[model samples]
Target: MVVPEHRVFDPASSDDRSIYDRLVELGGVHVFDTTATQLHSLRALLPTPPEDVLGEEVRWVHYPWRRSLVRVLGPRGFRLLRLDRNRNKITAAEQDDMARLCVGVVGLSVGHAVAHTLAIEGLCGELRLADFDDLDLSNLNRVPASLFDLDINKTVVAARRIAELDPYMSVVPYPDGLVESTFESFMDGLDIVIDECDSLDTKLVLREHARRRGIPVVMETSDGGILDVERFDLEPERPLLHGLLGDLDASALKNITPEQKAPLAARILDPSKLTPRMLASVPEIGRTLSTWPQLGSDVALGGASVAAVVRAFGIGTPPPSGRIRINLDAHLAAISEVEPTASGESISPANQPR
Candidate 1:
């Protein structure tokens, strides 16, 4: 029998490693994108290193995980203790409350951004992540990942990113993707569910399950920065897809093709609200491109935006429930004038802004 990961990893140990010890241990920490990090010797960095809780002469500690042995700086509890500034926005009590939240994120393409943002804000205590897809060069357009992460399973990639940010955050990854057996468990105790998966079947099924349990669901679509919120807890009998999927049954949704999903997406999201480019591209998907167009900015903002809404929910002040659209094209669209050539032709690349 396969043992569940929770049974194997001690939560208390993970907390200690992240908070008190060197997070970088040879193989456990990797160098990606930029140049390899060069750290001064531990003693050199801290000329007069402070002692640990024991009050003994203390310095560095070896990281607990991974195959290779490596050592680096401190049992830095002092630095962690000095995070009073975080208390300015999130009160000490609220910070503690944030740590108790259990969030479920399905689909890592956009979910990775959501997961990483939550960790940075010290939001989730436990994250239940599900994704079956593998990263490719194409994924870099949205996911804030390195070329090194290419080909890695999306769930695992999100888990690793979460760990790097908040080691204390317990991340349970569904690398095989969400299926029948584990589906129920995935929904059991989530404070909120962030649904970004493409599978229409899973979307409906998840909303049904979450609605029954009174858990709210939030979704961010790729185009025009559209975010849909279903407060199923407040409106228990709310229909799936806000009753958009009323006629269709779950079986019809199973193993659905992209062609089958297009009209449905257009319906729920409203084709009129779709960008002109996206509206035009939908018909030529298979011919011009393999999938829909999404940018790193949109996905990143989507995650951060979800974190803000969820943070409000976690603390006592819940945000207004409904669709929220942060229009990037409208807000951050570039304004530039074409450089004129001596002959009134196109200018050279060198003439463009650096």
Candidate 2:
């Protein structure tokens, strides 16, 4: 049983008498049982005597069983009763498994959306949130924060909100983004990591770290309507990102200048296969340093969809790895699963973005 640190329970004060006393104070016990056991149960279950009174007579009431009976039979008893009501519908083993999941989400921009869904779904026992960016006016359009949170860092805001939503949820906030120095501590004792950061460097680092640690990762790329779930637990013979960047190390890859990176990225992305609408944003984005283009609606869609995938994975449902693209424009979605070629070269898809 998970015990909440702060449970709401109010004991009767000197100003307040027992339920039977309050009931008799009205006139008589009009709606109460006559038998001792039933009366005891009724007295135990009443929260403030149902807002009515019958007479004024101080009766001997059992104080010990009051809270227990209320918990088991009162109007708000569903909080406790629902646990067993849905038992047959959910596997006992699966519920037990879900209660033990600990997931770390990096980047609180879209991650806030993911955390909101996960906290509401009661999917994780503990959530670790990381981000260094502060909330800006522009974030109001998409992030969970508002104008009130304008100056506050996202991780701090997200942690407080998560606590308010579910007090039992253990939330650890890292005000700094995960870098080489912070990676080990942040990744420690975590069952899974969800990459929601916008930095390609951070994504690459997280993927490498997860691969090294043999942890599974579910990353959401709202810009491309892509959700990538990588299962390092499977121990694929080739290195990580084999299907995306081939077998080149980060140092070797970074030595290529921006001019070279562009064509390489274009080749890897194969923009020739992109629809005109998809290509339209590229020129505008290219003028501004080639940051990825994201549709506003993709944030909500990707967050909710990826959260569902995470819950499914948590409950032991098998999900495919690699990129799962949901093209809202075309009302189409596809899963591309790739394996390294015989020569250990990555197989590039025509429509995938670099």
Name the lDDT value of residue 335 in candidate 2: 39
lDDT of each: 0.71, 0.62
Stretches of candidate 2 off by over 4 Å are 1-93, 236-238, 251-278, 286-290, 332-354
Winner by lDDT: 1
Model 2 lowest lDDT segment of ten: 63-72
Which residue runs does candidate 1 get wrong by more than 4 Å?
Answer: 1-84, 332-354
Model 2 lDDT tens row, 1-354: 111222222233443345444534665223322334533444454242342321122222222212211211222221122233335444546655766888899988889888777766656778888888889877776786767678877887776666544444577778777866788988888878888875555667777888888778887766456677788877644355545666656556544545455554544345774546556655554466554455557778777877777778767884866666666765544435555667887664644347
- Local lDDT at 96 for model 2: 54
The residue pairs found clashing in candidate 1 are: none
List per-candidate RMSD values in Å.
Answer: 9.0, 14.0
